[model samples]
Target: MQETGVKLSREIVTALVEDATAAPSMHNAQPWKFLFRPSDSVFQVYADLDRAMPHADPTTRALHLGCAAALFNLRVAAAHAGWEPVTRLLPDPADPRLLAEVALAGATAPENDLAPLYPAIHRRHTSRQPFTDEEIPRAVKDALSGAALIEGARLVFPDAWHVQTVLDLVGDAEGRDATEPAAAEELRNWTRVGAGAADAARDGVPDYAFGPRGRHGSAPVRDFAGQQSVPGRGTAVFEGTPQLAVLGTPGDRPKDWLRAGQAMERVLLQATLDGLATSLTSQALERPELRWTVRDPQSAMGFAQMVLRLGYGPSGPGTPRRPVDEVLDIE
Candidate 1:
């Protein structure tokens, strides 16, 4: 066998990992680890089981989704660094922990100008504030739909009636979760708010991202502030009616979750690039019954993986992230 002596430099590897870490994760858990083997020039993506949110994600679906989003970012970063990332998903059947393996092939220029999206990566966040009443233009919606399709997922924008149905279902999920001691306790542990020493803590959704206490007759937005003892974390009249998109896949499986996660980030980054504000509400999708209902009856789409709200409004404050050192592993 002939040996092709191609090598991946450490600097390019570090740059790619840095961009990967910027991808969003549920509650910013960043539940992933990357192992790079220079001998074969392969980067192995692994799920950090310790960071999994067991209560909300018993099957580790959400965690896999998050890691997959990071993996996508790694590919884009590699592309920008002049390398084509050749990816293998679920490379080992027996070892389910190994999510993917990316080999660094020779560089190939991105023909379609994916460079525009590279900027929105770190800029995107889960905006909880009610978006302005202004609706997103049809063109923008179509563009985002394309983004979802590219990542092997479908974006369903519910009409007025369907939108209301989704909101109601999410409201029910929020109310039930509020009263359920186990669910509420889990939320409390992951929600960090208030000032002083503890505020410096890493992980969990911060207080700034929490917009106002629960409002009456409003779109369902997760009120992390309400879960905290401290009250009054700013207020805003959330857009009375905002566009919602349901992201779904044809099948329900681990690979589907990863695809959904990548599609979610793709849509989000495109929205950010298009000068639109966005927020995600997975409360309804968190429950199995509610999840099935969120899927558009008209489409072949299965249970929805996420519900996203889009509009023109102020960008939410930046949420803290664990330094790259914490999430990225070098080997």
Candidate 2:
């Protein structure tokens, strides 16, 4: 019998990879690759440097975070399939390209507690529409924060003045991006406008996922659709006061990103489970100067991984993903 599990097989690898692909990417780039070593029943995730956005993620920080998010999803799927995944991040320093290795081992049924989140995996999306004005209950906030904590990250909700300050910084970042030709060009290249050949391109934000255009008042969320000119979008007022939360870690490193990504997905999934919508804007964080301002002055959190806005509103439409076969390599 195989030592990994009572039911170890390559078929489980396929299912796990399929679920991992559902994770969110910067522009649905899905800039990740997975190799399954059936001999040891181990799966390795690799960053596809070819699909990386040179300007937005020159350091591959965002790319790493995105892939890590998928890695979390992979574990969730594996657990659901009644296997325990043992993951090691950046397993080989010499192999900088290798993101992680997840081997299916141990015969364990999915934890009763974890079973619920698996369902939320398919339901979560990056909702860009304005959330309702109603404030989220404190209990819900606590739960979401706890989810982040469980994954080795901190979730801090800013006060009113802090939230306003972050918003201003976001505005500043937008203005800079508007003036910087390179940044604007990068955004244009990745943002999808229509269902034309441009839209069919492998990487870039798609039209349907784009939020409606906003006036100068608020830093409008990236309009993947309008960025190109996709038709049939409805205009709606964005939430005047959004519940802003920051996911942070004590230090910034590749492993920190991996942990943060896992925390991020856990929080996002829990928020969805609670019927809340989330939209992430890393625009401010993209610019070094503006990114610093998003962090609360009171906390020792070193760097911010993501700026999440949560509230209630229309759920976003499902974004497309590359076929599993394109991402999974079994050997």
Candidate 3:
């Protein structure tokens, strides 16, 4: 009598939420929450404004990016579990904080494309360490761009000129962070320095994952440590020409940001599957003035949401995530 192949259960919701939280965010803040209503088999992804970095994400753009990244992971996890997730962004106009609504309907045919990325969900982490100067194959780049395209966004690999522009803008952002007390304070508030704290931290980037201080090469990696010295942290030379991809959308709105975030995680998961080390930076995008110039002039991408560095190198250690219990509330 049963027509549906899969049914939503509390256990399944728990597992899916766990996989979703593994997505990368600004400072690993994990600015997301999930509320599962088993009665309707719907999962509500909400923006946890408490986790928002006020100074760094004044408009909450980066916060939206992080939440949508988790949303993408949730879709992959659901598809892998043989459930088709019907998702809507900004579903409720009255509630600005509710980022997405995912209704799970049993699937006669699950999303094959998304199910393949399930394994990469937890495997993909923001690698802050130095990447080698190996050129990524054209095929890999095309796949990544295609991934973004399907998510209603564009992933553009910048030309050499645009790459240098990004580096310069990144440097500018750093310089501002150094001089601006608010920016410096925001960075300090989110990063864990001590061994005990970093070890016990449920969220935020830990000192151990900060990678070596950039003595040279100046890869686009954000120096989480800043001026605060980690006792054992050492300096290393990063890749000279960091391969950068700009993930953007035609319009810069809440929905567009959500799409960009989903596209971003899709690209990252694919990159991880392809065995590429990855790290992303919102430093330049943090500052409104610098954010505009991040996009390539010739590219059709209207706005740059995130700058990603991809190459062959260490995949970096896994960062901590808040427990599912802490982030998810079952109804």
Candidate 4:
């Protein structure tokens, strides 16, 4: 990590940020910025409020979740680079926009655990495509739950009835998105179809990543196209029994949201390492009125932060990300 053991170079900083920005965000809205202070080797993460989804994520809970996931990736990158990441979330009360601050210090002991996940950082993508009905192994499921728990969050694999509940909620939310002008407009604004997707520089959900519409069964893939005609988009039958997991924390504060973000990414990365395709949907949790009901009454989890679709199938196409220069600055 320290080529000269004296100062950190700009190239290294940019690379770290590049890995950081690979995190998933609602609508592919990479809503985070990084400031690298070379003097102290500290990177400051801030939420780019402009990239926030106002209609779908009105409270910016999803925005915070995205930023925090980016922050978690930074930690993994730093560890893989042989620098210990010392992170502080919501570092400034005066400036609520400051989501996290990470100091990259030399590690005396190697980060064996985090370094392994660095590879999955690149391999893991949201798989909007249909997955097989094959059940995930018990050991793999346990590992994923452990990953979330390690980051101060809980992952609950709901029963059959609860899975149906989640599917129903997604249907309800999607219907609302159609009827509500604000949500429909926001969805259009965030999606790229036809030429828009092919020439997309960065950000937003490209049509290719939209996956096939679920012709049959209970897959919760969001139709990013809404009603627009994507010339080459195809439709396919999805899994009848889609395996879903709910990631949540006891509290719903900004800090808690940040922790849940880290937990969610860790689970995704671990799942990737274990050879499982994945996707995410929060339509049910996005609507405030329907959020609480998404959580199972029997579960100890409080606020549902994310709903993950996991299985063994084709991983979704990679979405575009803003260039490091566009989102990162050296001070």
Per-residue C-alpha lDDT of model 2 across residues 92-210, encoded as one tens digit per residue: 99998899998878654545345468998889998877777788999999999999988899999989898888888887777777777787777777666656844465556676677
Write candidate 3's Cα lDDT for 33-148 as tens digits: 99987667788999999988888899999999999999999999988887887789998999999999988777726325789899999888778888888899999999999999
How many collisions per candidate? 1, 1, 0, 0
Q: Candidate 4: worst 10 consecutive residues by lDDT?
A: 1-10
When summed lDDT is taken over every stretch of 10 residues in candidate 1, the lowest stretch is 1-10
The Cα error of candidate 4 at residue 326, in Å, is: 0.5
RMSD of each: 2.2, 2.4, 2.1, 2.3
lDDT of 1 by residue, 236-284 (tens): 5666676899999998898888889889888988999899888888888
Question: Model 2: residues >4 Å from true position, as ranges?
Answer: 1-10, 109-113, 197-203, 215-220, 225-228
lDDT of 4 by residue, 63-168 (tens): 9999999999999998888877878888789999999998876772553477789999988899988899899998899999999999999999999999999999
Candidate 1 Cα errors over 4 Å, as ranges: 1-11, 110-113, 197-199, 214-217
**What's the residue-level lDDT of 300 in candidate 1?**
72
* TM-score between model 4 and native: 0.96
Residue 112 in model 2: shift from native, Å?
7.1
Model 4 stretches astray by more than 4 angstroms: 1-6
Q: Pick the candidate with the highest lDDT.
A: 3
Could you tell me the C-alpha RMSD of candidate 3 in Å? 2.1
Off by over 4 Å in 3: 1-6, 108-111
Q: How accurate locally is residue 330 in candidate 1, as Cα lDDT from 0 to 100?
A: 61
> Which scores greater on lDDT, model 3 or model 4?
3
At residue 18, give the lDDT of candidate 2: 82
